[model samples]
Target: MEPTQWTLTETFQFPAEYGKAVSAQEVKVTAGYTEHQTEDAVRLSGIYHVAANVGFDGEGKEATLDSDAILIDDVDVQDQSGYFEYAVPLLVDLPTSADGQLTATVIDASATATDDGSLAVMWTVEAKLANVEAVAQNVEGELTKTALATDETAKESKQEVAQVTEETTTAAVTPDLESSQVETVTGYVDDNEMLAFINDLEDDVTVTSFRLNDVFVE
Candidate 1:
């Protein structure tokens, strides 16, 4: 059945990769995100907040099938924007991880207008799944080609001649170092660094890592 709300223009995974193994918690943390941008001024004339989901669909089906959710993240400077970004959190206990479509949809939209007609919204929902980025995919690095030059050996040397020869050696390398010459950081930065980065944002932002059974809702 085709969706009348929003048609699937294109189908692609969020990170375009999936996990074949599960994690320690028996759940696979298949991480991914999506952007849903609303178009058509008429459709977005007076719309405000947008309700989003980052879960998965039914098994062996696209995200549009039956999926749980990670969480919904709000987009910036999106007054009329139906655009949203989110990540899926896999908390189920199982072996190996998974990769699925990073699906996005306009589940619910509210009209802020005084009067409404069809109460329509034009949105572009893009989702992705099964994303496998190499360990160094987001990694920044450089590479160069090195060539060695050797003088042609004396072809007619019959006797063992320890001839003094200068050989050309090539070495290509660069600094992955931070260049400060201080102690190198081995792992990801602490929350301080994360907070500092958030401070750079133009709008208010909050970042938190929640643990299950640790959070209680009324």
Candidate 2:
């Protein structure tokens, strides 16, 4: 399957002085599949909101942050994006506490005055994801399969009509028949067997593990 490339772009405006940093609150965030910009497909979209407590200093205003959230289309963005998605959050050069909470940082801000005589600062953030692959279909539960590779002798053997069975018995069975079954089962012995592989996309790591459940002839 071919990998689908994705890019995320976000832009918003905040209030600030020419040289001072500005904090933005309730910044509108929107995202969608770049392909939708030109193609006709069910576009993926995301929503987010930024909030902060505003304080004015001289002619400039600073913000004490309150709440910021990025929602994935219809799915809630968790601290950890489990299984199939990756979420990497960066607060620029802002400081964070031991528990991973943003403390404070002064943003170098610029502002534009609105019709109501209010200064609006602006900000833009973007990210590019490469080789982001999505599986075409999901396989669930457990699958059990057996592969059969008959030997040359078994392939050349002729089959005789089986007797109608109330006790369940074959008309004829030979060492060659048993030997063919043994070869088929042993074919898997030297081959590489994989039980499961885990890809931790959030952390950019992959792990492969193997386990032997059972190998028996009934």
The numbered model that scores best in lDDT is: 2
Scanning candidate 1 in windows of ten residues, the lowest lDDT window is 19-28
Clash count (model 2, backbone only): 2
Residues 33-104, candidate 2, lDDT per residue (tens digit)? 222221322233333222222222224344332234222222222221111122233322211212211112
TM-score of each: 0.16, 0.19
Candidate 2 residue pairs that clash: 14-121, 26-50
Query: Residue 107 in model 1: shift from native, Å?
Result: 14
RMSD in order of candidates: 42.1, 33.8
Which residue runs does candidate 1 get wrong by more than 4 Å? Answer: 1-118, 140-218
lDDT of each: 0.28, 0.30
Q: Please provide, for model 1 over 1-218, each residue's C-alpha lDDT reduced to its tens digit, 9 standing for 90 to 100.
A: 12223321111122111211011111111222332333421111112232232222112222221132222223222222222332322211111222322333444332211111111222333222323464245332221111111122333342234232212121124443565333345233565697688789776554666888899978
Once model 1 is optimally superposed onto the true structure by TM-score, how far is the C-alpha of residue 82 displaced, in angstroms?
16
